[model samples]
Target: MSLTIKNLSFSYPDKAVLKNISLSNLPKGKLTVLLGPNAAGKSTFFRSLAGLVDADYEQILINDESLSELTAAERTQRVCYMPQIFSTQAMLTVFEVVLLAQKQLNSWSVTEEDVQSVDALLKQFEIEHLAQRYISELSGGQQQLVSICQAMARSAELFLLDEPTSALDLRHQLQVMQRLKDETQQRDVITIIALHDLSLAARFADNILLMKDGKLQGHGETEFMFSSPLIEDIYGIEIELFRNSKGSLVVTSELK
Candidate 1:
């Protein structure tokens, strides 16, 4: 499956946020990093795909089916959008949150299979110890992981993560990205994540989409999109890109 966006645009009465955006053939089983500066409409674009925001043009196609044609419930089943932050004021445990996500509060009783599934998902993210803890008490990064677990519980076909690693420490950041990569490949799910960390994006992204000023600047493999000119153009910073001893791309701004 591939995600194809054609002539898609979203705007408010005052001004336009996304302009004539067109991206095509974003392949499945790979993590695509959406890179851009702040206020580049990355999050809004994710919302458009999630059916949270209306687009001026309805041309988003997933595997040749128009996303505009799907009902809200159908869209929810297919797409999972994890915003940059979430409200933690709800008095719910991590386990309960995951269970609720699966059943959507339709039933009061939680099944043993639901518990087992939630347990396995927590263990996969190494947050099983916090299963019984209240989500409001956990740290931001931990809560983000729970949100991921919730998304996983829903078994959505498309994952749209907005700065998923923003609050994570170095270790958890790597862990989350690696887990996403592994899951995307294993499940053949299309994962599109917005990220500001170029280094991490370079390392984990199978493909990269660079956006600026509500427009697509470049889209292709990591190697091609990580060029010096492109980096400088989007970020307004000079940087050097080179392969490490292990053949992985390393991005650094300092001169050696």
Candidate 2:
């Protein structure tokens, strides 16, 4: 199952966000990184694929079917998009919040399997004990994790996550990225994640799509941007790439 996005563009009433953007169907089972700085339309692009943000139907296709063919529920089932903004101030507990997502599995009813999966996800994130804790009571980082787990709990083939590690600490960030990578390989899921950490992106992503100002600046293999020019163009900063004694890629800013 592949996704095709052609000439997809969007704009707020006052500001144009995406220009003439087109990306081909990404292969199944490969991890792709949408790399961009702030306000480069990364989250907007994810929304376009999930059909949450309005777009021209002719431009967005999931599998061979147009995104227009899928109902809101159907789209939610096929694609899991972790939006940039999430807040649960409804006095719902963490477990309760997850249960809410499980409820999305079926419109009118929740199932035993859904509950079981919710339990599994809670445990997977090592937040099983916090299950009973109110979402309003959790720390910002903890809240972020619970929200992410809720998003991941959806049985979706395509996962579009926006800066999932932003709220996580270094260790949890690594854990989450590793888990996503492992799950994608195990299930052959098509995953697209937006990340600012180049090291993490280099370590896991099979393909990297670099964007600047709502335009694609680079799209290729993991090792394609070893040079300084491309990085400078997309990031607008001088950077240096070095190999550690252990031979891992290290990216550092180059001072003028």
Candidate 3:
């Protein structure tokens, strides 16, 4: 699977959110990280891909098929997008919510496979205990993990996750990233995640797409795109990367 975008632009009557942005072919079996500051059009771009926002001139092709021509149901079957903010006030249990999402793309009647799959997914995130818990009773971090499971249950070819680990603690954040990487490779899904944590992006992303001022500043391998100069330019903060005792790349911002 692959996604190609060309001459993509969007506006909101008062101001432009994305300027003539274009990205080359983004192939499957890899996690691509979208990094940028706030209000930098990262979420807007994901909205367009999810068919929530209208584009002025977008030629988005998924596996050579035109995304713009697909119907709402067709898009849902092919792409799963998890927004940054979500309401956790639902009265349904975690398992029920996931079952509902699966039913949307599959059968209405719950099957043994569905039950087993949801159970396993919850276990993967170490949240199996929350399966029967009401969604309204879970904390923000728990809800986020449940939302991620809902998106994963769809098994879409393209997964667009915005700030997926925003509310998680350090341990869960690492777990989520590792799980996403393993799932992406195993399923051969084209997973694009919008992240503010440059260190995590650098550690997990197979490729990186940097955006600034509604435009793509760079797109390539993580090692090539992640440079002090580029980070300083895109984030407007001087930074440096160093190998810790564990030989992991760590990003540290330098105050001017």
Residue by residue across 1-256, what tens digits does model 1's lDDT show?
A: 6999988898999889999999888999999999999999999999988888888775887767788788988888889888888899988999889888887555788889888888888999889999889999999889998988887777778899999888899999888999999999998989999999988998899999989888988899998888747867678887778899988787876432
TM-score of each: 0.95, 0.91, 0.95
Q: Which candidate gets the maximum TM-score versus the true structure?
A: 3
What lDDT score is found at residue 199 in candidate 1?
Answer: 89
At residue 219, give the lDDT of candidate 1.
91
| Residue 230 lDDT, candidate 1, scale 0-100 | 82
TM-score for model 1? 0.95
lDDT tens readout by residue for model 2, 1-256: 6777777778889877887787787877888888888888898888877878886535566667677777887888888888766785768888878888767735667778777888999999899999989898888788889888987777787899988888889899888888888878888888999998888887778888888787777677777764537867677677777777987666777544
Considering only N, C-alpha and C atoms within 3 Å, which residue pairs clash in candidate 2? none
Residue pairs with backbone atoms closer than 3 Å in model 3 (clashes):
none
Instruction: Tell me the tens digit of each residue's lDDT in model 3 across 1-256.
Output: 5988898898999999999888878989999999999999999989988889887665888878888788988998988999999887779999898888777846557889878988888887788999899999999999999988988888688899999999999999999999999999999989999999988987889999888878888889887777637868778787777778987777777665
Q: Which regions of candidate 3 fall more than 4 Å away from where they truly are? A: 105-107
Q: Residue 140's C-alpha lDDT in candidate 2?
A: 74
- CA deviation > 4 Å runs, candidate 2: 105-110, 226-228, 245-247
